[model samples]
Target: MELRHLRYFTVVAETGGFGRAARMLHVAQSAISEQIRDLERELGVSLFNRENRRVRLTHEGEQFLEDARTVLDAANRAVTNMQRSQRGELGKLTVGFFVGGMGPFFSSIIREFRRVYPGIQVSLVEMAPGMQYQALQAGSIDVSFTRALPAIHASQLRSEPLRNEPFYAVLLRTHPLARKKTISIRELSEETFVLNDRRYSPAVFDKVITLCTEAGFSPKIGATGSVSSGVIALVEAGEGVAILPQGSRILSSSDIVWIPLSDKDAVIDMVLAWSPKLEQPALRSFLELVRRRRKQVGI
Candidate 1:
């Protein structure tokens, strides 16, 4: 039907109720209901099942939600594109990230880029590593700061390696292992290890596991966290020790100490990833700033 119908459907599906969706859309409750009814009738399918004062999407509705949201989002972006055309810059850039990627360089690059291109709006979204790849393919993200290496179809996209950061073992200040000037993967056999959630450090997890396996002992992975800050905080609380990539030293807690791995001095290459199909001038400038910041920081 009309674009308004798609908007109403998305609002309803997201809020899961006509009354609340109406409040969010600032439309009359009856109007919201009328639009959804029109949408369902036009599609010859029921989108929602109403039961016991709760609402949920049917199987057909669940499958169609993504298509509807895409149509609505594309329409909105078209409007922004027209305005950006007048300003000669991209309207918006959505960049995805995980914690260990680019660390300080990521923020510095964005700050400098926005300073020069105030008209272009940039949004940062933090998602899991696998989700970052999925988001990029889904057109939900334009660029990503990720530890995923180029071998994983990363070469198919437009990307540049920003820096390589060595991994370090972070231990609690009170732990006996903390007294050591340096540690190795084999030495961490009995240590409780905090793992980073797979989205932020997929490569790290794989590498750590592989290294531990090669050393004749599997690391005792204990607590887990989605962000580097959370892992560091857990280490400070004595829950477990964690392996951190280089540049994360900047986020060190006062009660924790970082020691390099003697035998496992492996590192990850921080990279900036984007689709070559995405040719926004502001996005291009943003990537340039990342390179400039790397040079400035002597990375």
Candidate 2:
């Protein structure tokens, strides 16, 4: 029999009479009696013993009642979980981001999201821009925080401006240029540049070259590191100076200084990108939270 049959049977059993079950269910007494009768017919068993004004469950009915409650409870839980998933409250969300690329606001936004939507399990993957693009395409990740994506993937994904991180002149605190409030791109031409390997961060590496070229000089390459912190470490040891994003300052040290670039185009856009085909409810929730805090992070 259908769920309504079990529901009516349980309600009649609970209330000890068809009349009260009908009142509690806001239905006609005849309708409740018909459904309960249908249930018993389907089972080929007498479920209740009718007396003068009330009914008592049979041995079979008592056992069926427990099973009915279990089934109903499971069905209710399944419906509740489905609704919560649709509301972006229950599910898994995988996000791919460049290491140290999201800057300060990224952490804050993630913290708030975790607090507000504790039911959504969040997994973070650290990927370069290229890998982020591929992960989005392959459905391995739901969202990515990255720099400008390749033109080929541009049309296939939707992106929003997250932050505009300006390039910085990284130097030893003892260096004369470190004392300047802002150092123009031209002033650092004579300095050797320490950089993260291009494979790890090709966008930043290319941007550094373009900025120096526009300043009428080619930066002399002194060393290369596999990561941002490695590059910063080289600069700290007086190996060479580095031109990095403003967010790189998060790897702060008293021996190093970060000065903003003066050139107009000395900036890069950090964006949040996701494949339209992979936009899940949980991802939508995250995007909403970012939009709310977008202005605070200079989006």
Candidate 3:
């Protein structure tokens, strides 16, 4: 009938006698008998054949005994799990990232979290900002690191600003503009630029176009792709120059040079965003880790 009833029934079935079950359950023999009778009555079947000397289970009782034990065991485990979750010890955490630059920090955070909370499991998904937002909205991910999220996606999520990485110009090592430590907007006006399509990373693209226009010339566009990595590869091949966040590290190559853009406001925010619907304990722990490491990244 209730959790207590199943627990009392299972104990009696295991011990095979009310007197012994009562002792094992820390209840009086009469109280144990009454609870087992109530469980049988609620189920509409006799669970045990009564005898002055020994007790045996009825056919229905044998099947019900197994079910009862299973229920009791599961209930106990649920309680234990919830208690651990409350202590930030046991749970699942799902996180999404927009770029690979977080690889080292994320790995360190995961190792530390495991040492501190061995019972929790974490899942990490890396995707572009738009896909990460959709995953958060659909309840597939709990938290994320993203850049240039739009107002529509921002409405469905809570974002915390972590750091700002200013724009930098990427060029082949032999390119003329690679000579400057920082180039003014006016200086790069005549250069051909390659980048992700406007629809892919709109905020950055719009700013780049506006800055170029404000500098008094339209950009001589060379190529556009749908991904950041693709844009970087094209820049590497000397197809065109590119402006991206300084956080976008250029790998070791003989032909690539990264130089900062001189505009004071030319920067992209790296932020932590999450759906408003989630308040999972494991997610909270992960956010704490992100916050700690974001500072190390100079947020």
Each prediction's TM-score versus the true structure:
0.62, 0.83, 0.78
Q: Which candidate achieves the best TM-score against the true structure?
A: 2
Model 1 lDDT on a 0 to 1 scale? 0.79
Ranking by lDDT: 2, 1, 3
Q: Lowest summed-lDDT stretch of 10 residues in model 1? A: 147-156
* Per-residue lDDT of model 2, residues 222-282, tens digit only: 9987778899999999999998887777787899989998899999889999999988899
Q: Which regions in candidate 3 have their CA more than 4 angstroms from the true location?
A: 10-29, 38-71, 86-88, 100-103, 250-252, 292-298
Off by over 4 Å in 2: 18-46, 51-53, 173-178, 295-299
Better of 1 and 2 by lDDT: 2
C-alpha lDDT score of every prediction, in listed order: 0.79, 0.87, 0.79
For candidate 3, write residues 1-299 as lDDT tens digits. 78988888888888889999989888999998998888878889999999646788989999998888888889999999999898678888787875533546556777887887788887888776767778888989888777756888878788888667778888888887678888887787778889767665666677788778777789989998566777888988778988877656744356788888888777777777888687677777777776877677775
TM-score of predicted model 2?
0.83
